[model samples]
Structures are given as C-alpha cells and as structure tokens.
Target: MTKLLLINAGSSSLKWQLVNMPAEHVIAAGQVERLNLPGTIVKVEVGHQKTKEVVETLDEIAAIDRVLKRLITVGGVQTLDEVEAVGHRVVAGGTLFKGPIKLTPSRIDQLRGLSELAPLHNPLEVKCIELLAQRLSGVPQYAVFDSAYFQGLPEKTAIYGIPYDWTKKYQIRRYGEHGISHQYLANRAAEMLKRPLSELNLITMHLGSGASITAVKNGQPFDTSMGLTPVTGVMMGTRSGDVDPTIVPYLMKRLGMETPEVVIQELNASSGLLGVSGVSSDMRDLHDAAKSNQRAKLAMDMFVNQVVKLVGGYYTEIGGADALVFAGGIGEKDPVIRQSIIDGLGVLGIKINQKLNEADHTGFLEAQDSRAKVMLIPTNEELAMARDVQRLMDAEK
Candidate 1:
C-alpha cells in the first residue's frame, strides 16, 4: 500500500493528513492555524493522541518546519520516501484546470498564473508545494483542485452572458469551490442511500466556517451557488455572500475609499456570522448564546435563512432531489440547525424521524419514516484525495 499525504495549504496555515492507502485509513492528521501570531497553535490528533503546540511567532516557513518535525518525530512518518505521493486541495482550477495535474515546475507556473483567480489561496499553496518539493526533491505531488470536478458542469449553466471580450480577456465566470467536498459527499450519500450515484439527485451543503452549496444531478455537479470565489455563496464565517455590485462603488464613494481592493478585502474578511453577531465565527458559540444574545440569535437566523434559500433554490434547479446531504463541521454535527433547515423542506416530502434522526450515530442521519432523506455523512476529502492519488499512482506504474 502506498501511503499518501494530503495538504490543504493556505497562505498563513496548513491542514494536513497522512493516510495509509489501499486501506484508506488515516495515520495522522493535524493543522497549523492562526499563522504568524503570538498565540499561534499547531494541533495534531491521531487516534487517541491529541497535542497542541503554541508558539509566539509562527511564520509560514516556521509553521511548515514545525509540522514536518512533528510528522517525523511524533507522528511515525520517519522519512520523506515513506510517503508515495502528496495531494493538495487547491482552491482554484479556473477553466484552465480540468483535472488533477502532477505537480511539476511548469505546473507550478500554471498555478501561479491561476493565482489571479484565487489571490488568497493558490499562491500560498504554490509556495507550500515549492518548499515541499525543494525539501523532498524526489517525491511527487498532485493538485486535486476544488474547481476541477465542476468542469463537468454544463456550459449553459457555467457561462454568464456578458461581453464576449471581457470574459475572453479576463476569464471571468463562475468557477465553483468546495467541489472536492461536494463530490465526496455526493458519492457517500449515494452509498449511504444504497442508490447509484447516477440515479440520485442530491443537494450537498458544506456548512463549516466557510460554507458552500451544490446541486448534484446524476453524480456530477449540475449547479453550485459559489462563484468565482468562496466569498460569493451562502453567508460564511467572515465573508459577506452575494452583495450587490453597487455596494462596491457605494462604499468607495461614501467612505472615501480609494480602491475596490480594500473593500473586497472587507467583504471577504469582515462580514458574515462574525460580522452580524459581533460574536465568534463559530456557529456553536452563537447557538449556545442564542438564548440571551440578540446578536447571536440574529446571526443564526440569518445564517439559517441563507441556507434555507440556497437549499430551496437548488431543489428547484435540480428539479427535485432525493437526498439533501450535510457535511463540514456545522452541517454534520448541528442537530438543531439541521432540523430547522429540514423542517422548512417539508414541501419536498422530506421528514426527519425525531427518534432516528436524533439517534443517527452511524453514516445515516435520516428519519426512518422520512420519504426524502437528510443525512449527516461526514465529508472525507482525504479519502477522495487518496483514492485519486492511488489511481494516479497506478497509472504511472
């Protein structure tokens, strides 16, 4: 079995997993979050072992150094060669990227070119790849981008009617994100439902700090709400989703803002649940405080409303869905919120068995009597990445 390492490398932090393939078993997983801060935290959880390391000044280089050290010294990955390959969760594939590409010098340049599409992410991921390749020169790496799977999306569904010249020149269009999670969950939901992937119409909601919704028909993405950026879909942790175009110039003129760049930054970084509640980005915190905090209650209401609207739209877009799958931190775990979302979908003939739904401990989180199922199938992006890596490795062999 070839062991694979998967990385979700960001500009400031890195989330990684090492899995034993063929078995698709996780050997270790960890995250280095809150980059370049005095209270920077590196967390590694393996089986029953969990450790958190806090540092004062955690830059990217230093963060990677600490992660590599832990992988070798603590996590039992003794050598670089012990791992057969690496897979990255690249955020933007644009139209230029269609499928997984072997990480190469030329591909690095291509990824750099795609940086204009994801100014915050692709560049950082490319940096991580460069550093890793330099340090482990002989090892192979591959990019399993969030936008690549959406390539199967219909041209009519993908293209926005705009000036042909503007789109041609700027490559501007909806390049969806969270595709890896959606693809993984869609297949998982099919399996859980004992239905073929092609036979099911599914709506998958990835509702973590950063959220996205997708409409999957016949196993492929039919439509997704997320646009050229992750900041365009349902309300997210700090991102304001689906703002009017006029808001940009309005802020620019009203606030005496010089450039749209900073305003864009504000939209992506300073809005959403955190902005609404003046509370934490976490839904759990908001939910807990909802009893007493008006802001928290309002935040949850807005978040749930956005999700309800998205689910409703997707149901209409896909004609009707057989299953509505929830993944990500919030979607998989938040029962109260899940109930609220599903309760609103009563018109679709979906019902949650209070007993079975609450007792959903296994892969299925559905009410036994419900016609249309609502599931809490945990998203396994690493397993999907490893499967892709396994296929690629076999192809090479």
Candidate 2:
C-alpha cells in the first residue's frame, strides 16, 4: 500500500491526513492549532482511536515535529519512511501557478516569492514543505494550490479597473480561493444530478469560517465572489469582506493608524461575524446566542443576506443554474442558515422542505416542483488533493 501524506498548513494551524493509495482510505488524520503559542492543541485520529493533547510549539517546525511524532506513536506508523509521497496545500499560487506541480528547488523559490500574495498562508505552507524536504529527503512532494481552478475565468471578471500597466506589473487579478473544494463540489453535484459535468451549471457555496461562492458553468469556474485575495468575498468568521477601498486610507486617518498593514490586519482579523456579533467567530455559537442577543441576530441576518445576494447574482451570471449546491461546515450542518437563505431567494422559486432540511446527511433540500435543485455536499478537499497527486505521479511514470 502506498501511504500518501496530505498537509494543509494554515496561518496558525496545520492539518494532515495519511491515506492509503489505490484503496483511497484514510489511515490517520490530525491537526495542530494555535501554533507558536501557549496552550497549543493537537488532535489525531486513527482507526477507532483518537488522541488530543495540549503542547507548546515554539514554531512551525516544532509543530511539524510534534505531528510526525504523534503520527508514528498514535497513528500506527512505524516510521516516517512508510509515507511514500507528500502533498502540500498552497493557498496562493498567484497567476504563475495554475495547477499542481512538483516542488523542485527552483519551483520552491518561485513559491516563496509569491508569499506577498498570500501572507497568511503561503509562508507557513512553504515552511512545512521545507521541513518535509529536510526530514524526508527522498520522498516526492507536490504543491496543490487553492486558487488553481479559477485560472480560466473570463477576462472581464478576472481583471480590475486599475491602470493596465500596474495590473500587469503587479499581477493584479481575481485569483479565487477554495478552488479545491469548489472543484470537488462541481463534479460531485454533477454525479448526484445524473448529468455530465460538461452539461451542468451550478452555484456552489462553501460557507465555513472562510466563505466564498462560485458560479460554475459546464464544469468550469465562471465567476467567484472572492477577488485577488480570500478577504474580498462575502462576510466570514473573522474577515471583513467587500469593504470600500477608501476605508483603508480613511480608517488610517480617522483611527490615527500609521500603516496600511495595520488597517489590513483589522479587516482580516477583527471584523466579520465576530465584529458584528461581538460574541464569537463561530456560527454555531452565534446561532445559540441569537435567540436573545440582538447583535448576534443581526450578524446572522447579514451573513444570510450576503449568501442570498451572491446566489442570486451568480444565478444570473451563469444564465441560471441547474442546482444550487451547499458545502463546507455550516452549509452541511446548519439547516436554519440554509432555510433562511432559501427563503430570501423566493423570487427565484426556490423552496426548501422542512423534513429534508432537518434530516441528517440529507443532500437534496429543495422541495418538489422547486425551480432548481438544492444539494448539500460535504467537501473533500483532501481527497481531491490526493487524487491530483496520484494523477501527476502516474503521468510521470
């Protein structure tokens, strides 16, 4: 059995899964949260066994070292040599990288240079890649990007109104995030609808803490809510999306701020649901508090409003969709949010069945005779990365 390691390194966390290829079954999975901070949490699951720990990791390398140790001890791996290949999830490939590629030294340098594009993600991902190169020198490693699926977007939608020279010199364009999840969703929705992907149109919603919607036409990305960065889309757990461009400079002067970086940090970390609710960044917590809290209710209302507007706009952009598919954390589990959004889309003749929405693991939520089908799909980005790795490896042979 070929053991493949899939790593998704975030700004403050790292998630990994070890899958047995050919079988395509997960052997073990784990994540380390709050890296380089006190009270770091690590969790691992293998077979029927699971373990959680609180250990301090001084940096990303130490976090990785802890992960490898847990993988061997709790995950049943005798040694790191058992893993035949590693796949790293890179958040921002910019325009330079459109697809998954082997991580050669020169390519790694290119990835490092693109760090300015995705400060929150690419640096840590590159650090993890470097660590893998050091500890497992012979293993073949791949960089699977999150923005790759949106490369073929229409020119009008990808380009901004900025000066042409600056746009070209700085590579300014809409490089949408969450492409791996969106790509998996488009294919799975086609399968569920019993239609060829090339013949189906879809509006796929990935609504976790970091949310984005995609208008997919015939298996390709037509338009997405996220722009050049993940912070440009609808409101998210902590990100303030779709803010006025002038707000940066205005806030700098108004708030007595000194730098653009400080303003950007506030938008990225201090805003979003947390800012609106003044409670928590988690939707579940917001939902629980909404019954008595006005701010929480308002936050929920704003989030649902954003989702409904995006769906309606994309529906028109795609010339009407065959189905509106929902994935990600809240989409799959939170029926209230789903119902609220569907209610807002009554103009489109979309109706939701209460029984179906309440059912666990239910995919079809649209009522009979509704104008379009509504589907709920659990995203499998790790599987998508694994499949891409397998494809690239096969092509090389």
Candidate 3:
C-alpha cells in the first residue's frame, strides 16, 4: 500500500492531498488558510466526510503539523509512517532544475540561490520542504517545479532583448511561470479533442489573481506571457504587468521615491485593477462597481482588452490555434467575462454560443459553427505534482 502526499504551500495558505499510489485515489485532501493570523481556518475532507475548524497556527509548519495529525485522527491513515513519499510544488527551479527531481541538501541549497527569481513564492515553499523533512525524516521527497514545463521553449522566445553579455552572465531570460497548469491543460485538451497532444496547437489562459497565458505548440510550451517572474504577464488583480521599464525611473523622480525597490513595490502591490478601479481587485467586485463607477468600468475594459490582445497575438504566433482553453478563477466561474473575451475575438472567426455559455454547457462553450474550439478545462497542479512523483518513484524500481 504505497501512499504519496502532495503539498502546495504559499505564504498564507497550505493545501495538501494524500493519495493512494498505483490506484491514484485521493484518500484525504485539506488546506489551512490565513496562517500566522487570528481566525485562521483549517478544512479537511477524507473519503465521504468533510470537516472545518478554526485553528491556531503560527506559520506554515504549524499548519502542516495540524494536517498530518488530522490524517491520523480521521483514520485516513493509521499512522504517518504509511506515507512512503512526499511531493512538493516548487515555483521556480531557475537554471539548475528543468524537471522533477529528488530533494537533497545540495539541491535545496540550489533552490535557495534561485529564491531571488521568485521572491514571493520560493522562500515559503522551501520552509515547507524543510519542515516536512524534519517531520517525516525517512520519507523520500521530490520537488516538482512549475518552471520545468517551460524550460523547453525555443531560444528566440526565451531570450530578453537585453545586452547579450548581460543576458548570458546573469541568466536573464524569460522563465515563464504557471507551467504546471499550462502543461495539464494541454494534455487535457488533447484527451477531450480525441487527438494526440503532440499534434495539437493550444492557447491556455490561466486567469486568476496572478494570471498568465501560454502558447503550446505540438503540446509543448512554445511561449508564455510571464518573463523572469510571474509579475510580467497580463494585468493581474494587483500586479502591474507589462509595464514600460522607463516608468520606474520616471516614477522615482516624480514621486520622490528613494529607490527602484519603492517603485517596484508599488507596481506589485498597488497597481493593476486595484489602482485603476479604485475599488476591489476581485473580478466580481470590479464588475459590480463597473456598473456605477467609470474607473471600475475602465479597469474591466482594460483587462478584457489585454486578454484579447494576448490571445490574438498568440493565435497568430502559433500559426492559428486549434483550441483556446480557459481555466483558473475568473475563467471558470464568470460567464460574462468569458463571453466578453470571446466576443472580442469574433473578428478571428471565433464565436461563442451565447445560449450554451449562459446555460452551463460542460466544457465546450464555442458555437457549433465556430472556426476554433474554446474549452473550459479546470487545472489541477497538485495532481500533476503527484503524477510526477509517482513517475520518478517508478523509475527508481
């Protein structure tokens, strides 16, 4: 009875799933949110039952400890020893790691060096990995990187237009984020279309708080919106994406900012929909405010325009896409936003079945006679991590 535990940890949230290997059944899944704060919540589901509680946790380590204890108390597993291996979702592997690899002291140090590449994500993830190692001392662990899937991008697409020497010396190429979601969607799209992934051209859009779009050529990532970090893609909930580099110095001089850090912080935390709308960063809230406020309407319009522009450009770059996939929060739930994006692409022979989109048809939202197919495929990055872990384990035998 082999079991694999998968973890995806952020600064304030820790999501975990315990799976039965070979069978691939998730025996237990859970999450702890709002860590290191009052009124923190812990939610867990085992088999047919579910539980939620307000718990105290100092940080991600404490949250993880609580989760493992719950697994034992709920009889999801008799003991922690039942777990044979653990899989961790690492956000940035940088140049050292291009795929899933076994966790080790040296490799962990290598990941630490790349922390500057993903300042907001990697440090927290590393802390989780370290804590997990102490708790499950003997269990083998694997790091499945989100950047691994995009490592195969062509040189022309990956290189930045910086000084050639600086690019080579600093490794300053585009290391696109959200590769896990994009990779999962590519294969899922192939399965639904009844075609081999290797033969399909896909444009996968992951539109959440931190959003990115990927151009998958023949099932591999050919290009992506994110560069160097997740903050360079299309406009996100709070992130100022695709900003002109010169704006940094301009803002510094005009606003009396002391350094670039101050300007960058504003772009990361205060810009995007929040700055433009002067309301909420959430799409739902933005839509509600757009009904009454001009700025909110402009923010929503700008978002839709950016999405359409990227999709259109990718469609052309990829020599016309066979399918356009929508995932993540805004892409899956908000039908109005989805419809607006599709309507914007009507000039490219892409049409949506307004009735079907509004009526909750399964995945296919495109009109019957549309030239290109549009699909609603939900992404499961944890499952992707688990699958990669099992694959690496199988190779060991």
- Most TM-score-accurate candidate: 2
| Residue-level lDDT tens digits of model 2 in 217-255 | 877899998888778889988788899999999999999
lDDT of 1 by residue, 126-197 (tens): 888888887767889998889987877887777678887886698777888878889999988887788899
How many clashing residue pairs appear in each of the predictions shown? Answer: 1, 0, 0
Off by over 4 Å in 2: 10-14, 30-45, 48-66, 135-137
- For lDDT, the strongest prediction is 2
TM-score of 3: 0.89
Off by over 4 Å in 3: 10-14, 31-43, 48-66, 73-75, 359-361
TM, every model: 0.89, 0.90, 0.89
Off by over 4 Å in 1: 10-14, 31-43, 47-63, 355-360
lDDT of 1 at 204: 93
